[model samples]
Target chain A: MNATPEQVVELLRQTNFSTLDWAIVVVYLCVSLVIGVWVKQYATDMAAYIGAGRSVGVWLGVATMTGTELGLVTVMYSAQIGFTGGFAAFHIAVIAGLVTFVVGATGFVVAPLRALGVLTIPEFYERRFDRKTRVVGGVLLSVAGVLNMGLFLKMGSIFIVGVTGLSPDSGALTVVMTVLLLLVLAYTVMGGMISVIITDYIQFVLLSFGLLLTVGVAIWRLGWENIFQVVAAEKGAAGFDPLQGEGEFGPEYVLWMLVVGLIGCAVWPTTVARALAMESTQAVRRQFMWSSISFTARFLIPNFFGICAFVFFSTHSTEMRELFLSPLPGGASSAFTPSLYAMPVFLGHLLPTGVLGIVAAAMIAAFMSTHDSYLLCWSSVITQDIIAPLAKSEMTDQRRIFITRLLIVAIGGFLLFWGLFYPLEGDTIWSYMAITGAVYFTGAIPVLVGGLYWKQASTAGAFSALLMGFTALVGLEPVRQTLAKTLAPVMGDSETIAAALSAERCGLAALLLTCVMFVAMSLLFPDTRPDARQRD
Target chain B: MSVWIMIWKVVFVIALSAFAVLAVGATIGGARDVVTLLNKLKQDRSNTKSDQ
Candidate 1:
């Protein structure tokens, strides 16, 4: 029998939360709270709070960094990508790791950034070039970071609402969102990097165990052959083929993922802060390389999960279609929650009681680890890097800590609102990230490279590169939509303007244009010689 | 196959040398000591530069 939506609903209904699941989430939450608060005892000063006192050894940093980069979204999205596109998603990990290695090896970003002792990426811009550059870069990074985070609150709440058996639109999503955000803010605001690093370490441990459990269980239930067979028959050539499955979105859709993940990987302020947290350039290189390895392992896991989801759903499509497409008010078709519910379905059906609890704990751990670090990373950048500079007197560490906490709450509040209203269209979390990332990655590249290599890369040049990159990236939405509408009648393709313009070629084109403009503008208006840029 | 495994093992060992530093950070005291040491290094470098 062909898979139907009814079967999917049956599957969803069949997989209700058990006592074991509750135990897992509760134990994990308690452990997280303890680990988080415990780190505060070591946080004596601002540096400890912000940068692990720059004493973070390479392994711990690598482990934590890998864990942070691969959060709940990674698990969900990688699986979604795998389910749909198969090996193509796997290629992305390989591509991302290789680029990371190249950049770390060649001093593409790290060397100059580390040497500056700056707290945020924009601070580097401000110091290397001008205030205008800092402001532009800062604003862009924040917007991109926040908007990209739109899914986190919604997804987190969805997980809670789904697991707890609350209807999707039950007003409880907001409450769950508030509670989780508060938990992250509490530890992050208290200890800064100290709390962040310590909690991240603990989180890394739990998340790895969770991943292993999931992988092991999936293998056990389906057997490798069964999983592969299902995926092959269901997804057909397109599912297994790395290159197919463009659908209504077109090729630019997939290409954008690669561009954004690769470029934006280095562009985040937290990443730079983590790099600077190390003791030496050698340490920075080592941390990132190992982190890359950890990332490799972490990245592959998601694709595996994604592929598994595809197989599972394809085989059970009849059930899912009925479950999802039924006339339920405020509830999306199971497809809306497919990736979110993928693991839950597997756990409820496949695992025995004790093991199920442990895996669920791991899942929560994975989510919290990423969320806490993000809170710590962003708040620190805003308070120490941006706010303090604007203040007249040197703010005390106490004041700084207070402000960072306040900002975390403020940012969390803002995200709560966004998550509540913003609807998910397409597999958007990653796409939004990629598009925004192109802005940051390409923008920072010119200024960073010029700061290191080109003697003639004036402050004006840096400023212009930053401004142009920011403007171009931020402006892409309108320009793309307009272009899409304009071209819609001409070309019969149903592709949105965003998808049409996001081709890898378009991304590369933007990169080239930005680089040339930066050079031209800088030479036309010089700020500092390359020799002068190196202070000592 | 053995040769590839051997190569990876050697790489892992080298990576462990770096890992040793991070392991030190596991302990609160050890992490603090490392931070203090880096600060001293930064200060010494600055002092030497000024002397020159």
Candidate 2:
């Protein structure tokens, strides 16, 4: 039953993607583009363009919300954790669903946000604090948001390469990244959120069918008992338990997942845009409450796929295992993506021919839907919040839309360049995303929670908390290494320094420090504005 | 699997089943809403065209 290495290579070649497969992907892309262009007439103003006129009904909201949030990069990273950490990784998804459900039931942050009907989160800041605070928040948010999206193109391309049997070092990777970016940019630049919502609905349908099919096939092909058996045999208790300190996740790591789970759905702009775009506060609640399932499945399903990959590789012969994890020719381990390629590579062998094409197309849809939403989100924030606020004159709806389109192009350009250049090392792609996003959410969460609930929240407090979030800059490999080198003499060991300032610690530290700063500054310099808490 | 793993397995099942139920119900509910909204949009657009 074990696949020899040659059989693995042969399997990869057999499913090298047929003409029909490419046609399916192309047709999906064309349909999305046509829908985007078609929707432009509906987006007649800034509200229609950026927030879909705040008219999105519940089902449309649920579908689009899932489409935007359950991005291909999300799948890639969740699966990566599954392959690396096994079933213990499922905790992340459980926490995600539970937090989202509690938030919905309690109407914690999102309900009030929906009630305010602000097009963007910073607009709330402008109302609660001041325009200057809004502008500063926008700048920090865009910096973090844009960087957060930077790796998206690279991760998506990696999936395509891994799925379709393209050489990791091939020119094909760059070509795929460019083509996917262009497809997303075309529709996004044309119609904004109107386009995104339509495309996302369609993508939701395709993505759901694809995910369901993949899960069924995986279960049938590799019986449920066998998957757990192999993982257990190869890894023992560590594979099944995240609580085990010796595995990838420790106490700090789990604590960080708790923070990330709360922030990912609750505070992240892309997800919150769905809340802001909904027809009513009630619709927002129902959407989140309904979406709790997809939230859990989003990470749970992909993590399952990744766990399957680990099991598949482990059960196979040694050479088959080496095919994925082995060092590149004339080099150490692969500097690019590394063992993260295992999931799609394993799937390529597992799925039948036409089915493979559908799954790949579905992921492509996911990649585009997410890119479109993110591109629209960050661009709109920069235009309405950062640029428009600082400008001397008010922007017309047409001008605002024009500037937004131009900014989308600029951000897409940066993503392509960043994706090509940034070499991921040491950290899993999921951790990379969490830490980068913490740069924004770590500070933003407290500012939002306090600004909404706390009576004494001052502009000074909000600003200082945002600045404190920069403490998480230690999560960056280069930044961590630089600081470690600088402190090595004092610390007695560079490795110890690296271990001390891990991504989990940095993120936790950032969140705690920012929370403390927000509280302290608000109490120290209480805002005297009578209407500050009430807002516009 | 240990008792801890068994507990987690149960948790995963319950969570996944709950999500499936919610997602399916939402999907049907959401589709109905979409149809209604689209019809309204169409009605408004035609009304504007008639006025013009």
Candidate 3:
């Protein structure tokens, strides 16, 4: 009684997506392209190209920040969390919002960084520590950032394929990923941050409304009271309480989330890029304060959709139950995991044709907005932080912009390749993203905090902390598996060891280790020059 | 568990409401900001050309 892939496709095809939806999606894509290309006139200099001339206002800043952070990949992963973890997943959203609010109010890391007026975080390293630290920090940031977004194209393509009821075997994932990448590269390379900002504003409007509308429809379809009842019956106490260790999340995971939440707003490059792009440090603070709402909604809304998807699947048919709920026979797996497809498939069935198209377009907007920002971000870091600094001669603005454009295309090509070949075998997409990001932030936290606040933070401390971040790479599933096997003789069981070295635990350990390394190294090798440390 | 459920429900509602206000406010305010940004960029380009 195992369902075949064909049978699963047939069940998925019972969606409300239609020709109208396709047309809507196409029109939206065309508009985004035009706006992105049209903004090229404004990108005449390095600052304009990469930082939108540092002229962004508070509201636009908020919109673009939300647009970038609340990406389609974010939606996919958060929904998966909601579907599997139920109400417990809400804790992550709560933590993200609260942490973001605190950062905004306290002006902890972002405001000071904004006050420094550097284009990238690594640039600050050169100013405070040394040129070598900047190059090392830049390299690590680019590597971790590029790796962090490796799965984005795959997740976005999955959402498109699942929502449109396309056959998983129809080669649609590759097609969608390629087209999306090309489109994002085309505009991002041309208009840079100006293009990113304009499109992000539109996307913010569309995605916010689309999310609210879809949630309203889903609540209507599955009665709110009944939705809770189903979760209670299916998942029990663990569904409601995140602190209940019976669920996917526990105390350790919550602590890790608090750290991740802080990094999401304060330390993450793309977000901090928005802060840097603002008209003033005050604007950066206000933008983050206002963006706290979107931060919460980004996770809370998608997670609700996931819970709804779970309810829909549980009640619908025996076929769905076999596909999604039941354990696979003999540990066989599908080309795509069923849990990842749950929210899009649920929306496919719940929304009517016209609404489905608008929502689909909005989701595509979300995908593109994030892609453009990230592509622009990593490429700029490579140019300004890595290549330009290391160059024997000063680079002209035109040459810098040209190189950045070339790098955007190159990065897009890498994304396509990585998306196709890399197996998404981790427990949750969220955990995978967090751990990948931890490889950068675990080290960055100590360096950024110590450098900004502590006068004693030496160049040696910064280098040691940045180098220590590489230890988090072992948290990746494939690496963890390899490690577990190597230690199996000593540890008794590979599976047990693998499970013991969970992504959250490893990430927490890396953060703690990096912090200690930073402090110890700074004390051991204090800078001799009194003027080395810059004061605010 | 019930308390947890209630807490989530409240948080969800507040988040939704706040986001709704933000969407509308940012949309209107962002439109004006976009115009300001473009004009500023234009001015900067003119200044650069004059200097050159």
Candidate 4:
């Protein structure tokens, strides 16, 4: 008889986590909170609060950038990719590294933006186009950014629950999510970017060493050669070749990854916020170039762990294989989904008590570093780009900071509610993130690149491009499913139609269409007057 | 093994090694940067007070 979902959960709960591990995690959390609160006095001005006084150096910039981007959510989703896609998933890491390196070497969008010395990306929109463009861009960016991170708290909580071997049905997930959010909000609202930068640096150090240690232990335990052998046996050429039509990813996915990679380093607001914080444009370039190593390793290391988890489960026992690989005992109605839990559960079993505690702390560090930066980034954008510009009276720096802190709390509340209620049923965490993120980046790529590079990028063109980004929302799983169901009678099969409207295809089409619209609109109805603030 | 698998193995090793080096370098260098940043903030605060 097939093992029930309850049995699987019971089996998963058997882990090496101990009281010693809990002490280590608690101590680390205390130190991070202390450091964050200690830095509150430094945030006496808007620049210090939001951009760390624009005093960041190259190595620090690289470290903070990695800390923010190599988030727990990134690890969970990348590992899930590896579990499902095998070696084919490594292509995404390679593309990410190369694209980041090129962006650094060329200083494409970052260099010019740094030279302008704007606090946010939408601030640049105002300088190049008009105040209206800035406000609209800010609104779009905040919406997409918040939606993109909607699953982060839940994903982090899932990691904590799995690694600690807590029973998922015992309300542990909700408790963990609430505690992590409260901790992050306490530090972030207190210290703003100053605390964020300091904490990110520390987290970067711990996460790097922790990752290497885990990978080393995994390789030693599983035997490197055996990993390849099993993957080759089970998945065939499709596992190794991303371009294989039967593989998890194909030509279109590879192309889409390239765009995603570019946007990740160059156009993403949180990453660009690092650039804005740097001491010089030269530092920004160097930071990205050096950060390419981290950008690649973040994905590559987690992916290897996922692959290891697959090997472990496959070789461990018959029941293990069935639990992870086979359809649910009762089919799609079953409550358990195994992919996201695989890596954490494997770690909980593999690592010893003390070492497991340290790694867990490091992962929590990753979680907090990402949350603080994101909360600060979005809240500041709303204050500086959206609200400040719209306010009739000139707002004081103190007023702006107060509003930002309040918004941070508001956004945190929304994340808690969304994480609890949102259905993560039909899509992978990574795909959900990409589709939501595309709602901003698809439009941003055109508006940012055009406004910076092309002389004729008008306010109207920018507006049209920014509005066109909403079309990428069709790639969301629920929306796509609804469209597919509604059209099934007329268009043959719902599943086939949904598959045809894949996230990559939709995102790429939206990107191309937005670019064309931007250019056409600019050429057709050029700005009547060249603004004095427009860059050459 | 197929060429694709071999390529990934090589790539993974290189990426991991490079990241290890970056981690060490960033740790030491980032410490000094943190000090420099704090000092700069202190100076900026003093300047603001004097202006007032």
Model 3 over residues A281-323: C-alpha lDDT tens digits? 8998999999999999999999999999999999998888777
If the candidates were sorted by their DockQ against the true structure, best first, what order would they fall in? 3, 4, 2, 1
Q: TM-scores, in order shown?
A: 0.82, 0.95, 0.98, 0.98
Measured by TM-score, how close is model 3 to the native structure?
0.98
The TM-score of predicted model 1 comes to 0.82
Tens-place lDDT digits, model 4, residues A1-536: 57765787787788999999999999999999999999899999898999999999999999999999999999999999999889889999999999999999999999999989999999999988899999999999999999999999999998998899887767888899999999999999989999999999999999989999999999999998999998899888888899987889999999999999999999999999999999999999999999999999888988888888988888888877877777666652233568988899989989999999999999999999999999999999999999999999999989999999999999999899998888987798989999999999999999999998898888889999999999999899999999999999999999999999998999999999899889999998899888546445
Q: Rank order by lDDT, top first?
A: 3, 4, 2, 1
List ranges where model 4 is wrong by over 4 Å. Answer: A331-335, A532-536
Candidate 4: fnat, from 0 to 1? 0.83
For candidate 3, give fnat to 2 decimals.
0.88
Per-candidate DockQ vs. reference: 0.07, 0.49, 0.89, 0.84
* Candidate 2 docking DockQ: 0.49
Q: Candidate 4 chain B: minimum summed lDDT over ten consecutive residues — where?
A: B1-10
Query: What are the lDDT figures for the candidates, one per model?
Result: 0.62, 0.83, 0.92, 0.92
Candidate 2 Cα misplacement greater than 4 A, ranges: A1-16, A325-336, A532-536, B15-23, B39-52
Q: Where is the poorest 10-residue window by lDDT in model 1 chain A?
A: A323-332
